[model samples]
Target: MSGILAGKRILVTGVITDASIGFHVAKFAQEEGAEVILTGFGRLSLVERIAKRLPKPAPVIELDVQNQEQLDGLEGKIREYLGDDASLDGVVHSIAFGPQGAFNFLEASWEDVSTAVHVSAYSLKSLTTACLPLMEERGGSVVGLTFDAQFAWPKYDWMGVAKAALESTSRYLARDLGAKNIRCNLIAAGPVKSMAARSIPGFEELADVWKHRAPIGWELSDAEPAARGVVGLLSDWFPKTTGEIVHVDGGVHMMGA
Candidate 1:
C-alpha cells in the first residue's frame, strides 16, 4: 500500500473486456494500492468476469447511467460493499455509446442522437452527481475518458459531438465542485482496438489518423499510457489541476496538419 493511490477507493465504470481502457484503469488503480469497484451496464456477467483479472478482488456493481433508478441507488449499492459510511477517493467514467445510425450523422434521427448524447455525454453529469454524496465530505477526483472531440474523425460522427458535450460538462463540474475540493478532469486518449472500437463503423479509418500523425507514434493496442494518465489525475500529484483534458494519445492531439 505504498503506491500513489495507497488506501484510496475508486469506482470504475464501462469495463467490458480486458482490452478496454476502463479495465486497465481498474487494474492499475489496484496495483497502485487502491481498492477498485466496477460498474457494468448491460452485461454484468461479462464485466464480473473481467474484474477477476484485476490485481486484486474488486466487487462489481450493476449500473446504467441512463437508468434513473440505478443512478439514484448507486451510493447505496456501493455502500453495500464498503459499508454505510463508505467513501470514494476517485471515480472513473469510461462509458460511451451511440446507435449505428449515429455513425451516419446526416441520416441520424433525434432518437439516435439523443441516445448518444444521453449515454455518452449526460451520463458524466448523472454519474458524478450520483457519487457526490460519497465524495463531498472529503473530496476526490472524478476522471472520465474521452476521445479528442476537438475535430471530426471518420465514422465518429454523432459520438464526437457527445464527446464534445462530455468535455464541456467536465469543465462545468470542475467549476462548481472545486469549492468542495473535488476535481473533475478528462483524459483524451487515442484509439485502441477494444470491444468498443469494434462497434464503431470504419474504426480503422479513424485509427489511421493516429498512424500518420502521432508525433511520438501511436499503438492501437496499448492502453497503459492512457490508464496511467487516469491514475496520475486521481493521485494527489494534481492537487491544483481540475477541468483539464490531458492528452494520452501519443501527442496526436497537438500535431498540426
Candidate 2:
C-alpha cells in the first residue's frame, strides 16, 4: 500500500454494487495506495460478496447508521478487527436513501422525510463522529456524496431537502472538526446510472437536467469522474479545504440555466 494514499487506512460505507459511487471510491482508493475497510449496511453477506470484487480483499464490518448501537460500537468493532494498530486516515460516507413516499413532494409524509434526512443527511455527522477516535489522532479526511440540493428537482423531493441538510451538516462538521484537524467535505455529483439512481421514480428526468444544462456536458453512465473527486478529497492534497462541496457534476452547478 504505497501510492498517493500510501500508509492510509480508509473506511468506506454504502457499497452495494459495482455501479455504486462507494464501489468506485473504494476501488480507486485502493489503486491509489490506501488500505480499505468497508461498513456493509444491513446486507453483510451481499456486501461481503461485493468486497471480494475490489482490487484487493477488504474486510467488511457491519454498520447501521441510524442504529445507535452500531454507531456506538463501530470503533471497537474496527479495533478488534484490525488489532490495536488500526488507525484511519480517511473515511468515505456514500450513504443515502429516501422512501418511496418521499419521492413525490406533494405526497410525502414527515415520517418518510425524516427517514431520508436521518439516513441521507444526519448519517454524515453520525459516521464522522463514530470514526473520529481513529481519525483525530492522526488528522484525516471525511468525504461523502451528495446531489445539488440548491433547487428542487423532479422526483427528488424530500431527498433533495435532505441533501440540503447534508450540505449544511458538512459545513458544520468542518467548523467543529477543524480543531481536531479532521476535514469533512462532500462531492455533489451529477446523476449516474447507479442502483440508487435507478430506484428513483423519475430518474431519467433528473438525468436530463445535466444533459441539457452542464456547460462541460455530462455522462449518465460513468461514475468514475465523480469517484475520482471523492478520492482526491480523501487524499492529503486538499489539506486546508473542509466544509466545502466540490461539484463533480460536469460544471452543472455553475450554470444559471
Candidate 3:
C-alpha cells in the first residue's frame, strides 16, 4: 500500500497468460499498490482464470477492440466495479492482432491490412478516448506496448506498418491530450515467447534478431523488464514524459546490421 502506484487505479488489457507482458504489468502494478482491472477479448473464461493467478484478485471485463459497441460501453463497464464517478490513473494497451494473410505483405489484401491496422493501431486511439472521461479531469498515463517499428523484421510484414501507425497515434494523442494533462507513451519491448508470439508465423526468426543484436543480451522468456518500464511510465515519476517510446529491448533497437 506504500508503493509508487499507491492509490492509483489502472486498467490493463490483453492478458491471456501468466507469461504475457500484460499479465506481468498487472501483477507489478498491483504489487506497487495500484488497483488493477483487466480486459480480455474472445476467451473471457480463460482470461478470468489467468487473472486469478495474480497476487491480488482483479476483476476481468470483456473487451474487443474491434467491437465498436464494446469500445463505446467500456467506461460504463469499468464503472460497474469502480462506481459511477470512478477515475483511472493509468491504462495499459497490450492488445494487437493480425490475420494470417497479414503475415504476407505482398499477397495481403486490403481486408487483411485493414484488420491489422484497426486492431493494432487504431485501437490505441479508441481505447484511450474511451477512457478519456475517466482520466481527463486529473490526467493520467496511457502506456501501450509496441515492437520497434523502425525496421522490418522477418515475417512481421504489415504488423510492422501497423506499429508505425500505433507509434504515430501515441504522439498525436500526446499532442492533443497534453492540454488535459494526459500523457501517452509506449514501450518498445523485445520479443518474448508469449501466446501472442506463438501466433506469429516464423516468430523465432524475429526472436533470433535479438539473440545477436541485443548488446546487453536478451531473454526471450523474460517480460519483467518491459513490464517494469510500463509501471515506471504509469507512476508519477515521468510526469513530463509523453509521446515517447522507451526501448526495453536490451539495446537491440540501437544495434545496426
Cα-based TM-score, every candidate: 0.99, 0.97, 0.99
List, residue by residue over 160-224, the lDDT tens digit for candidate 3.
99999999999999999999999999999999999999999999998998888899999999999
Best by lDDT: 3
**What is candidate 3's local distance difference test score?**
0.96
Pick by lDDT: 2 or 3, better one:
3
Candidate 2 deviant stretches above 4 angstroms: none
User: CA lDDT of each candidate?
Assistant: 0.94, 0.91, 0.96
Q: Once model 1 is optimally superposed onto the true structure by TM-score, how far is the C-alpha of residue 192 displaced, in angstroms?
A: 0.6
